[model samples]
Target: MNRRRIAVVTGSRAEYGLLAGLMRLLAADPRIELQVVVTGMHLEPRFGHTIEAIERDGFAIAARVPILEDGDSELASARSVGRAVIGLAEAFERLKPAMVVVLGDRTEILGAAQAAMLLRIPLAHIHGGEATEGAVDDMVRHAITKMAQLHFAAAEPYARRIIQMGEDPSRVHMTGAPGLDAIRDLRLKDAPELGAELGFPLEPGPLLLATYHPVTMDPTASVAGIEALLRALDRFPQARVIITGVNSDAGRDAVTGRIAAFSAGRANVLVKDSLGQVNYLSAMALAAAVVGNSSSGIIEAPALGVPTVNIGPRQGGRLRAASIIDCAEDDGAITDAIVRALDPAFRAGWPNPLSLYGQGDSAARIAAILAEAEPCLIKPFRDLGV
Candidate 1:
């Protein structure tokens, strides 16, 4: 049988982790030929040469389009997107894929989808119809939703929102968050062993795992927010802290600079560009509390039955589990939230915590849908209610 050729794009390590299970599913299925498009931070050395990480997973990349060039400013980022659109369109023309599957909200996917749209290739998007009030990806995600022919939401409400935006309800599928696929299927390493692997030596005390990004709504506050979080963390002098680097946002310099300078001599702190997917998820599972503006605190932590102290407005309007403690981006507020998340009495209340997302089998469902949804030119705008 001539398999359906589907092209997949991954630009960063984080989204690659989320898409891991589904990629494997499509690769092994006899009906789908996976065309991997690798770009963005994956090709950059500073972000950890993540393309190598992707290759290590046994998928042969079909295209390596380099678009970024020292993206330290907004103009550079815009130019990079233009380059991506041009490069990605060429990739689409060559591959002639039946469909293009892109995930999450990032410049990489946005530009890739633009290329697919102009080439009249079918586009499928994941993690659509959600809100992230403080970040730039909020707008990026909605834009991708408009371009997509099929939408896979991690939650039901998100699916409804896509329909509200005039997308056909039939094209929207609630398959849950793919990030949990690793949590449910992978054997996450325990604290002491993971600590040894990460070189952090997580002692017998509370561990705070955090990853903060630049809030597009107010870039200036990104630095101040991290400072407040660090000050709050300082209150727990015995706490073991593991911090991953910031994403490629305009004002990211301030956040990483603060982290590097603050953690320079702190014996209890460890900072890195990345810990890979397995090590990172293992760290999350073993952590005393997941802290920061990351959506992981909202989606992954609750599923792991771990407490989350979500600081600031980055994840402002997203659906959350009952175990989440939301607080302003202030030292006192963050400190108190962390304290509350660590309280035994509060922890006792969530003996059977549940995720608002999914049961972690989204990959198989997504793969099946992609193999069947062939490319087309006539995608009439789906009405608001029909």
Candidate 2:
């Protein structure tokens, strides 16, 4: 009846929000000893030092590993990854967990996966086999899938992709996207309440919740894309905009700089470094349209029955619900997409949009699997006999 020690590594606010439900379940399970390892943006001040959010949620942080360099260039991202691998390896060595859990395709998460692999600790990867073609996440995600002994894909197509990647079929589970669990479980605040918390009025116009991240594959596009989005927002002068901070990716500084300039002295626009998880979901729940290239627009926004204007190729290859409108990273295209998302006819057309990921039960399933499943250091590649 000895409990298994499973360490979960989270490096960003978004990743932490998705992993929070699973972590809570793991911590509650009598047969599991949950170890929380905070790193990357969680340790960086510019990204809001979100490790405080984890501590506020009452989880004991087993380790704090600062792995980011001082810049947002490609070289900085590479150096950060290098630092992450070494720092996370040392932390894993101290925790000595039976398995390590990671979510998504961030470079820091990749480092954690590598560290776990080199240390011979079985790894469990969530959101595996998904693609973000415009960013380097596509490569990092698949790499982690290959390294992991247990794979929890967010959807059937993703599970199939993981199997196609030569992972053992038995090890892959379609647990849905843990992001949706927050939408289902949390009592989302109403528009007025959310507005009060955000220090803005949600009324007098449509509310747009927007977030943008760097397209690491094209560094120059980050600034240009944010500029286009800002221009598009200008077309809707009456709309209230909430632009969240950029992630700590390559070219992040450029995007953040552009957003800051755009929001400055604009009474209709608000910029926030971190809204945490609750306020974010509340805003999404009440938004006229979720506008951005962030995956939350694809996964969580549609699940909340909110239309998403997903700009550019950043989210290419992920499953798209009818509620999502894909557009190029141009002001004209983005503005048109936002227009469609706000049309009452368009919103009514897809009432109760089917969630392709799952029914918000991902965390429980993932927690149960981790509690009972045996972790192996070696996984023989499964071929399709092709």
Candidate 3:
């Protein structure tokens, strides 16, 4: 019997981290053939040439699509997406897999979904139906949910949200998060090794792991918002912060500049271009709290029983575990949240064994479903009856 062919698209280091386990499971399964497509920041040097990380893990790269140029302006980003659409369409036609899998709300993923739609290929979307009102990702995620034939939601509410969006309930599955699956099966690196790899030392006292990205819809807010976060961290004299670089977005340069300036003579702060999954998860394990607008604080931090201080509109409406504390973009509010997160009493009360997003076996479940499901031909938008 011929094996089923499944293509997974990854645009950045973060998306690739979440999809890594799923790719491995599909690759190892005797009944499925995995086709990995790399694009977006993975091809950029500033993001640490993330494609090398993927290849280092032994997964085969079936195609490499270069969609993003050195364009950070809004029009430039849109043009990049247009270019990606053409490249992805050609690649999908050549590969012709039974289904294309895309994760999260990055524009590149959306471009891939659009390509798959135009080519009449089935799309399997992960992390859909969750809201992120702070940025345009909320809209992109929902749009992909509608375009997708199969939905693997991270949490139950997310799964229900997909159904509420007029998706066939039978087609949506609560598969938790593939990122959490890595935490379950993989042993994290030690703090010293992690620090050395990222070219920083792990300081004593409470730790704050921060990752911020530009809000594509509100680029102006990026700089001020990050400034507020840095000022808030300044109030915590006993705490050390580890800052990860921003994504390749419109206002990313501004945010990166602010982070560089803030980390300049501070012995308590370390900023890095990127930290692979191992170091990232290890940092999460060691940190007293995570402070940033990144989705990792909302989705992955809860699984580790760590407190997450989610700042600003970037992750505005996403479902979060009890471990997260949402604060507005104000230095005072962020400082208060950090103080509260470090309180032992407050940390003890945080909900553990929280399965808001499934039980970490999402990869196996997603793969099993994909292996058994039949692909459907794409229909007209009018036929969708939305």
Return the top candidate by TM-score: 2
TM-score of every model versus the real structure: 0.97, 0.98, 0.95
Model 2, range 106-187, lDDT digits (tens) per residue?
A: 9999999999999999999999999889999999999999999999999999999999999999999999999999998998
lDDT of 1 by residue, 1-386 (tens): 99899999999999999988999999998998999999888998888989998999999999998888675567777788898999999999999998999999988789999999999898999999999989888988999999989999999999999888888777889999999888988888988889878777887778889888887778888988999998898899899999897888777778889999989899999998988989988888888999999888999999998889998899987997888999999999999999898887877767464788988888888888888875665667767533
Better of 2 and 3 by lDDT: 2
How far is 362's C-alpha from truth in model 2 (Å)?
0.2
Q: Once superposed on the true structure, which residue ranges of model 2 sit more than 4 Å away at CA?
A: none
Q: Model 1: runs farther than 4 Å from truth? A: 351-353
Clash tally, candidates in order: 0, 0, 1
What is the alpha-carbon lDDT of model 3 when measured against the actual structure? Answer: 0.86
TM-score-wise, the better of 1 and 2 is 2
Question: What TM-score does candidate 2 get on C-alpha atoms?
Answer: 0.98
Deviation (Å) of 198 in candidate 2: 1.7
Top-scoring candidate (lDDT): 2
* Candidate 3 lDDT by residue in tens digits, 1-386: 79888999998988888999889889998988899999999998987889999999999899999988675777767887897899999999999898999999988988999999989899999999888887878888888888899889988888878888777777889988888898898899777777777666676667889888887778988888999998988888677789997998777888888999999999889887778888889999889999999988987888888899999888887777888899988999999998889888886765558537778899999988998988876433332434
Residue 328 displacement in candidate 1 (angstroms):
0.9
lDDT of 3 at 196: 76
Each prediction's RMSD over C-alphas, in Å, is 1.3, 0.9, 2.1
